[model samples]
Target: MLPPRTYVFFGLNAVRILGIISMLLVFASSIFVLVHDVQAVNRFMAEASESDMQDCDYIPGSTVPNQPAGVFWAVVNRLLIIFQVIILILSEVGWPLAFFDRFFPVLGSAFGLGALGIFQALIGAAILSHHVDDFTLVTAFFLFAIGCLNMLLGLIFREGAKARRSITNWRAQAKSVLPSAEDFRPAFVRPNSSFVPSMFKSGAGEERAEKSGFGFGRQGEKAAGLKGFLISKPLESLPRYAPPPRSEGSRSNSPEPQFKSSKYAI
Candidate 1:
């Protein structure tokens, strides 16, 4: 049943470490991939494909149409998008709680939905027929990566749900093992209040020698005292089913372990 809450704690830690390692790698990879090739970094930055170059065209005297830079921009945007998604998901789900519980999984699901939207668009569009291999590979990688992350989030939520079910079952069993509220409740006191000595004062106030009915506290005290304070009654004097007293002397002389107790009245 999800191996208890302790296992969940371990799962959380593992998820955090995994996220940290992944985030650093993804961030570095995103930045490193920003350049098209070795030449782009070494030479292109100095030239003016930089967009800082004024647009110009020689259609006689027409304004220059902006030239599409290269697939490098596409790759850069995709990388940035992926890195952003990773950072967001890890921050929302993979932090303090791993095996992310309810909230993060929901957020991850929303991200998955967004990814699905892109997947749909990629599947429908055909702008890169000449570079079919390139477009297909990039699209497939994005979909696969997003799907895997979404699936991991689902697993975390599934485990949390399992843990919840087990707790419910434990509560059901524990209710049966536990003593009921009524069992520990003393009849001499208020329904939930502490034992009050005044409950025992009634028997002592009878006008006649002993005509009044026995008070609840007197009966309880006498019964408890027989076990704890007067366990030395002779066999003939004991109740029919009474077992032999474990102690035969006053409590002060008893060899049995005694709990030292002090009472406070409020």
Candidate 2:
């Protein structure tokens, strides 16, 4: 699997960089509006030859007359005031989001983007509608939001690519570890006892006498004392190399000695 630490650190840094950029844009745009507001007031005060009424704070003080903007400059000045407030709000959010983003960087980035995109796009659309030709300084905010969105997408794709490679490598390793089918074979588990004389009896009690040392019957005489398959010549008996196998009914005791009788009529 992909290393978790590398993936998370890289993804987090991407979000942090985006946040810093957002904050920078906020500061830059705010300063531009503040300077523009001062310049407009100075030009008006210089032409009218009156005392200064505007404050040097973030936004220009609200109009004392409480009337709609009359001249083009008046409209431009009020728009600048709105832009200043937005910049302060954005800057407040950006740096704080960056700090909190380490735990859930992706989610934090999405949250930041949501706020940034809506406000910047709204302002951009408004500027375009007004045909304001000198909004270059404030345009940084729009670009920054768009840039953050791209960075977030890039991080997502990078993690996905790493994960896919890890899976492929795992499957390849498993294939190497598994045993092959060609090495398998079954076993033989039973004894070979097919050579008994009864097997050649042909479904009867009589067995065909043959010179192959297998016999079960003779003419009409029956050797009654102790009958067994006998050999005509000892050399034609069972092979000499084979071990003597005891018969099923035979015992280990010695056989009785044979008795001899004198030739006399009783």
Candidate 3:
């Protein structure tokens, strides 16, 4: 058994499909009127005299004086307009009830196109009554085509809604099946102890030195004064003749022996 929401979705889709079919019907009817009826009307108007052209009513069984074809096309055009209006209303109502998001614009477009179709139909009828031209019929055809496109867009939006719903359902299902971060566990047991000490433990000596106000080298002695900030002479600037310092052990082990020059006797 299907869920209630699924039923609603299917119902909305059915309404949308019906709207598209009606729009196509309107488009085809307009084309028929343009090709068959409009041409026949134009031919009759062209052949008839000025006296015959003045009256809008069609006379039956008379070839030169009547335009029954034009009257029939006008009637069919108006009927199509009525059908388009009903479909537009259904679409506007159905889309809002089905989808809770971002469907108003699509509804508005359909409404606008339906209105344009009616307007064009009326204008075409008026023009056909008096002055029938190629431009009139072409414009009417184009307007009906736009209405069909609006229906096609609505169908596309319906498909998009279905896709969005499917994705949302998939995400919900995945979230239900997958474990959360807190529940995750490693395959192997990890050691709690580390060879390297923590920063907090390492900083203990430095903290004690800071509290005693003595530097790192000697304990019980204060830090160096501002003279420490002065730069010492670089190695290259030191006197070359100066001897290197000797270690305490080496100095203590030295024997008190007199040195003899190379020119003197040993």
lDDT of each: 0.43, 0.45, 0.48
Model 3 Cα RMSD, Å? 21.8
Give the 10-residue window scoring lowest on summed lDDT in candidate 3.
Answer: 59-68
Candidate 2 C-alpha error for residue 166, in Å = 23
lDDT of 3 at 170: 43
lDDT of 1 at 153: 46
Off by over 4 Å in 3: 58-266
In model 2, the runs with Cα more than 4 Å from the true position are 1-12, 48-116, 123-135, 138-266
Question: TM-scores for all candidates?
Answer: 0.30, 0.30, 0.31
Backbone clashes for every candidate come to 0, 0, 0
What is the TM-score of candidate 3? Answer: 0.31
Q: Write the per-residue lDDT of candidate 2 for residues 78-101, one digit (tens) a residue.
A: 457466435534442444555435
* lDDT-based ranking: 3, 2, 1
